[model samples]
Target chain A: MGKKTFIILAFQISLFNFFVTAQSLPEVKAHQKLMVEEEEKEEYEFARESKNEVEMVFSGLFLGYKKFISSQDGNTCVFTPSCSEYALMSIKKHGIILGTANAFDRLTRCNGLSPEKYRKDPESTLMIDKLE
Target chain B: MNIVKEKLSVFFILIFSLLGATKGHTQDLHQTFAFANELIESEQYERALLTFHRVLFFGKGSYQEEIFHQMGTCYYELQDFENAARYYDLAYFAEKNDSIKIELTFKKTSSLLLNKDYGYAQIELFNLPDNLNPYFSQKRNFYEGITYFGLGNFTESEKKFLRALPSGNAEEKEEIKQIFKNLEKVEKISPKKARILSMFIPGLGQVYAGDWRNGLNSFLLNAGFAVLAVQTAFQYSIWDVAISILPWYQRYHMGGYMGAERIAYEKIEREKGLIYSEILEVISETKTD
Candidate 1:
């Protein structure tokens, strides 16, 4: 082939290869159920302290649970977070007076509530195993 | 005889002191490992990996394999599967026991697969035996299926998943079932066909790929560019077509076709993920209950 034709052909081949590579994708592994993080351990251990307890409660009150739910799998929550975090957030955001009355139900809802694991260094609210 | 006795006593003293120092070294290493574990628990994963590396470098203890495994866990948690797989590979080779070797290999396979290092994952799958303990065997097949799926060999993936389903526990069974259900031979518009269709009529490929809004946008954008290019060529000069209109038209047209194929594959993958995750939720709930 002529030099110009060879150059054109090479460019086309490279472009096609780029598109093929882009189409073939990788899988994301789910975190193993008892995969403990240091942050969660710290949070759980410090949770017994009155200061940490109030901080967690205050965070939940500030729609932290809502943000947590949105971050994981985007619009998909298994009952674990759906039940616990949503209830907590709903109660805290909507009803200060009724939230106090509905404390028992609220506690029951988030029984298996798990905070999302971070891809890097970040605060974790509870030990996953403890939540489980 | 007295000279010989004195020499033997001096040698024994040296041996005992060496033993004592070795014991102390081991204890210090253990304490360091314990501290690293604490750091890991606090979510200081990067530091923990460094600490584990330090322990590996300074210590020549029996816990070498275990330390490599721990490093793998830290990297895996960070989603740095490349490093995780590397450490797991090291651990797999170092592990002497068959069961532990199998376990580390399994972890290595997953880390490789997740990192999109399919070549290594494939090699690990081949190295793995089907005659392992029932649990490992099932896990082995499942990871094999995952590797195949990553390579987009759907038929092999299906076959492996079928094998895994029979031997898997409740969770794997459900996972396999969802995969089977999602990959059920429903006809999807061929991405190649979509690309061809859109090559002729710019938005058709996106429409076929079920991206209706994009399809319409692509159609309008390409049609508008085509009109401008034609008008420019006829009314003023081919220079405008060459300089501006043609490039935009070609770029978007190519993008539209490629995007359609990409979206098609992504839609199927996304649906499968949803099915799997929803089942996982139920399983999690049942376990909790």
Candidate 2:
């Protein structure tokens, strides 16, 4: 009976030790209490921003130079004032702030900054590979 | 006397053993937290988030607030502002200490702002009781101003921002003033004018609004329809205009006019957003500084 009780106590200690060790493993995530470093921005995002810059410059000049002539038919165009008309007129009215803004909006029309689509996913660590 | 001493000695030994076990348990908890922190370090955010939550759910540890706050940070890192706001809110309410409440409230408010739940953030700012904590109050007011700016209530936003200016450090004050100046510079584009302009020329509205590419495209499309209607009428009959040209013309013409007003208004909104984002960047950078 004495031997059996001792064995039981030893087993319990072993189990407790195992539990502590398991808690410390890299895979066991519990309440993340630290900062995760940000990864570099995607290449395409940078490229798109650069292209937008170029468009902004050219569009400003193009709209600033000429006014559209009157057409014969009843408004053939769909957009009432149209994109070019808006750009030209807004620039003429509000200066480049409105003009540049209008051009930028048009450049990425209907595509709001889609955080859901662009959110960064966390990378798996190579520290301990659980190879199947 | 000896028997009594022996019993007392055994009781002390039992107490020590219990204390040792308790220490071991606490150490395990520490290791668990460390492991979770490591997950964050590894950039395994989703798993890290889950682990933090698990610690809250099962671990009867004392750092529940810390865990939830860490979860908030993880979501913030992911740029999932909605989730970050939710978790920050969780952390705010779960926090027991008054000292930490201010920090949590600030985090929750910012997260709400980033989530674009401007209305809620405004309310949360009000709830912070500006009368009590002057430091957080000033910061809160600045963010409140930003929220109003985001909502396009520029006047009210400017008022809130002005109130914050008198109290901030000189550099911060200068930053706020710059933002204020920029705020005044923001202009509204009238939708009515855009519609009227587009009425005469389909794509003219977009051109006037500064979208020359789409403007040109709109003109060409409608012009193509016009040409089709004229040519098809000459080729077949006026009835051919219906099948070939009128339908396409009508769609684009209507779209162009409506789109002009919509897109012009969208331009104003976009400009406001850009300015707001710039201000936010400056203020947020100042936070790190």
Candidate 3:
């Protein structure tokens, strides 16, 4: 080929190669990492501090009942949180008045009558119900 | 004719044997690098990483920077961001060329960012010289903006993001500013308001929080308990009503308000998640150099 023709062909090949390289370059994209700050879960502990004397007394009585009466009764409750613990939690959170009432409400609901009302706990056969 | 054929066969066999021996003996550093690169091209990052390590173990200091860079790429492909960052750091230190060093630093920072180590990414980004090519300077600003965003400094992030774009690209800059502006108005439910609402009327809080099913259930349960209490008081003595029906009424009433508060809090969290995803979408769609 003549020199001028060869130069033109060389220039075209170089331009083609440049375009190919540019096309093959990885596209810039924003990272999709989640920016949500994870909140640490607090561990549940029995015998946590009570807000008043009434609550303290109730907690002590509940603990005594669990150790003596409830323990001897065997794990008969069908609810996952169990009846006694639920009562304690309700009282601790809502105070003695409403807590006692909630405890009674839980007692009425624990008769295994309406199984479809609660989800089944995956860990065990107990129905999944907890303090709201 | 028979003798000529035998000689020709011997000559061909000698040539073939020599070629095979030469190929077997020439497992050089360049060839090893080529093989590792081929493995990387095939997406066999694990095997490529091993081969790169072998090259690093056996070869001299000739391909040190390149080997580290290759190893970083392999780790990046394997989704091992921590090791990718480490190798990229090594490559950055090993490289003498200013451009390659800048690229290595960017890679290291990117790896750190992907691992959500924003603090480290910021530090790496700050280590780069102020005087850089325009492309790299824009990239540095972009990375700094992302680092600050991850660290929850929106004002600084916005400033960095604004700086990241070219001075003349008004449309993209405005789009970014709009995304930041929308961040302030992200929908969030007030747990206190929800609780107050439920206290006045059973399940109202839950409904306000967009949990209609739970709200309906709460309303029905509380209303049912109230009806039962009234019926018990009429049929039996007030003492019987107080002992049995009153407790149930109180329990459901109190539980309803508490549950409303929790539901509202959860609703806020869900809304925040959606806003975050929307922000990410806008960012992904925005073009960067």
Candidate 4:
């Protein structure tokens, strides 16, 4: 009787193990948390330290103009980059001589004379005449 | 001894009963799949995906291929072609039957094609065995042609597309042949010519390219700068004109030519796309007929 009981108990334990194995379910993968890394441009920074004396002077003047005069002038430029900002960028990109000329051209183009010439920026509804 | 024997008998009965219950639960997998299918039918794909995944998790590999295929369909419906292609690939490998594998391969290629991964789609089509059956062969040829077309290999695309047509249908084949020939003779405006025209005269290239308004704007801007230079030269000096006005004139002049070239290129690309769509329409009509 003791031997018979041991065999029955062992058989039951095996059956229990089988059922447990069948019941074990893997966790579902979460597709919602897909990793998407986007490169976002930082729009504002203080200034880059200029290597040359001329660039240093221009940067200082531009910063001073922005802080004192341009701040009080309001957002009046028709282009998305604005005139003063375009001047700073163009100068930074192409040095003072050509950059100054580009800035003056931008000012002339800002006159809203030919609205059909440029696409309106979706955000600002301004003519999108960015420096080439 | 009597008490021990009675307790052991009760335990045995309990174990049997539990096993029966477990079996009954296992039987409910089919019903669960039906419920998931209903969710799919109702277009509740997200819910259906979760439910189907649940079935896959619990069921003991009973319909693994079908479940994977269903999941791929769900992802496809959601327009997530990347995931759809992945699941279809899984289904393709898991399936045992040849016909079903062919179908899954076609589906996987389609997902890749729709995602605009033409290179990968072409590779997948090439991996398929040559000439398994007529119906799938035509499908493979058509898909290969589309892949080649997307890759801008027009000659290869033409060959594959012609092969995809029925051999017996001479009239339809001739019509498709004529279309491809017409595509070769398509009158695309030369971007270089447009640029040269603009360089010769501000906005002339744009006018020739059918964008008169932009051309007018370019001409006016250049003329304004020219007038400014002359006025500055007379009022102040030629030095002031050189410093202030010349740069503006030069930029607008260069920009006008470049813009004309871009406009011409875009118009030609648009025309090509329209022709491609027309070809596809004709092919689809022939198929339906």
DockQ winner: 3
TM-score of chain A of 3: 0.62
lDDT of 4: 0.74
DockQ of each: 0.01, 0.02, 0.05, 0.02
Find the 10 residues in a row with the least total lDDT in model 4 chain B. B280-289
How does chain A of every candidate compare to the true chain A by TM-score?
0.22, 0.25, 0.62, 0.60
Output the TM-score of candidate 3: 0.55
In model 3, pairs of residues that clash are none
Candidate number with greatest lDDT: 3
TM match of model 4 to true structure: 0.62
How would you encode candidate 1's per-residue C-alpha lDDT over B142-244 as one tens digit per residue? 6766667667676786676555543214554566566566656423547787778888887787788777876887787778888899999999899978997
Encode model 3's per-residue lDDT on B259-279: one tens digit a residue.
788877776555554544554
Best by TM-score: 4
Query: Model 3, residue B183: displacement in angstroms?
Result: 1.1
In order, how many clashes per candidate?
A: 6, 43, 0, 0
Q: Ten residues in a row with the worst lDDT in model 3 chain B?
A: B280-289
Q: Which stretches of candidate 3 lie over 4 Å from their true place?
A: A1-30, A33-132, B1-28, B60-62, B187-289
Residue A39 Cα positional deviation in candidate 3, in Å, after optimal superposition: 16
Q: What is the lDDT of candidate 3?
A: 0.76
Tens-digit lDDT track of model 2 for B1-289: 9999999999999999999999987787777788889999999888898778767665875687788889998997787878888888888888888757777776777677666788888888777754644445555666667678767687787676555443233575477567667646437466777778887987788877777876886788788778888888988999878876786677768777787877777776666656555554444433221
Q: Evaluated on chain B only, what is the TM-score of candidate 1? A: 0.70
